[model samples]
Target: MDEKEVPSLAEIHIAASHLRSMSLPITPILTSSILNTLTGRNIYLKCENFQRTGSFKSRGALNAVLNAMKIDPNLKGFVTHSSGNHGQALSYAASIVKRPCVVVVPRGTPKNKTDAIEHYGAELVICEPTPASRTSTCLQISQERDFLIIPPFDHPDVIAGQGTIAVELLEQVPDLDAILVPVSGGGLISGIALYAKRINPNIRIFACTPEGKMLEECLNKQERLWPEPPQFLNTKCEACRLQQCGSLTFPIMCSLVEKQVFTVSDKTMIDATRFAFERLKLVVELAAGLSLGAIISQSDRLDSNIRNIALILCGGNIDLNEKLPWQQ
Candidate 1:
């Protein structure tokens, strides 16, 4: 769906109001010295690490589920395949509404990811870490059990819900020049770009994917009659390394966004991770640190006059003990 066709400003205001009524915590933190020092720009870290279920996925999940609940009071079940955070978000949402959940997780997904889902009382189904298998497994289960598919980053409601982040950011930093967001399936970035651009067409929305991932190519392919699957490039940022971008997100990003796609080495993610722990005094996972890494990698590209910037800290659900490849 053309994000433009999805909702009007007046309609979006009502949607945003409905989301706010859920009482989910929205955090917009202004703390990032390294980013400031590197780019000579005032940076605000939208610290969504403190969000419910410890990630921004909660925003999209709740929006999808509650909206689904409104349509179908007896929502049969909930289902999704995620690397980590999104699964936990869906499971937590399911628990709140007392619905059964079946999560299809990649085989190598961290133990903590599975644990969180189970803790929320959702059944876990593990599959190979590939886009084909993830989709296939989720479809199979959804067919058998009649579960509502809550895609990680690929639905209109989910993207608009995630856009609420940009809504809060624009309110928090009215003069914000740029916003950096991590790109796994493009839900968060799509949402942010849609609303931010609708408000101020000049705001640049950067897509920060794992190093070497062909996100720029993926975004372009989104315009075709039969768009190809996202070309998966393997990297140590497992949480953010998707085989492809989401179908719904890809098209919206290609049409609406003007920002270029950039990448940071696993090393930058590691350093940024440590930086968040040491300097920001927060426990952020590799996915959360990608925004910092993107700013660091593209520090030279940004105009020095661009003083106000925003980075979306997406999640913090990694197993702290497991040595990420960058750490070693």
Candidate 2:
């Protein structure tokens, strides 16, 4: 779809209504004293981590699959490239709809993640985790078996589905002034920013990225950093280490996002994960901590009057018991 054809507020609402009509729960919960102490604001956590399939990706994946079925009743299946969360989401969604799913993942993808995808009955196709390799493999597979492409973050339907989070958050916390979200291909933040800002122009959207990925630096400098062989992209975060933002998402974020913050280290992420585990009693992955650490680190920039700040707790699809680099 052309960038001009991106979903507007009206279209987003239609997509959100589709999700609500299907009886999918969009869980938005108020933060506890731990979050308040950490962020120095009355933080509200939109626990997409507790969403269907245990991540926010289910919203977009389910919406895309259902919409595809509408377009083609015989829509054979769906395909995408994801290390973990999105793959599991698509696989689980397809299982519910009784549609086939084939996920193309990198060879380096963790076994636990691939197993989760397979557990939901999606066929796994492992390949190199580069734009060229992923696209080539997906196209080759699609040609052999008619599978619709459910890109992780590049499509309009996916963004519109993700925008539903903002819609729900607005209703749950009507007076929210800021929203913090972890950025990978920029899909979630783009959707949330568009819908939330359209409703309240005063709402500030912040993008949180892993420091190792350097996405925040790229966005802040307005230049692509890992713009070389594409294989240089940091895949450590597993889910989000793409070299560039989604073509559909970046442009929307250029105007919508208030700031982009890069995390310091994996150690910080581990610490935040443990903190969430002990304090919030939530199982957040390292990627999710990228957002929390951003807020904790940048407390000075936050506006004092910003009482209700929403954090999109995007996912909890990682093996927390595994030894992190920090543990060593």
Error of 2 at 62 (Å): 1.2
For candidate 1, lDDT tens digit of each residue in 141-196?
99999999998887777877788888888888878888888888788888888888
Which regions of candidate 2 fall more than 4 Å away from where they truly are?
A: 1-3, 128-131, 212-226, 231-236, 260-262, 324-328
Q: In lDDT terms, which candidate is top?
A: 1
User: What does the lDDT come to for candidate 2?
Assistant: 0.79
lDDT (0-100) at residue 56 of candidate 2?
Answer: 89
Please state the error at residue 115 of candidate 1 in Å.
Answer: 0.5
Worst 10 residues of 2 by lDDT: 229-238
Q: Give the number of colliding residue pairs in candidate 2.
A: 0
**What TM-score quantifies how close candidate 2 is to the native fold?**
0.91
Question: Which digits, one per residue and each the tens of the lDDT, describe model 2 over residues 1-328?
Answer: 2446577888788878888877789686857886788777887878887888778898888878878888899888888877778889899888978989999998887788888899999999989856788889988888889888898888888888898899899999878888988888888888898899889999988887766666666666665665655533343565566556876887777767864564546566667766767778888777777776666667667778877888777888767557743465
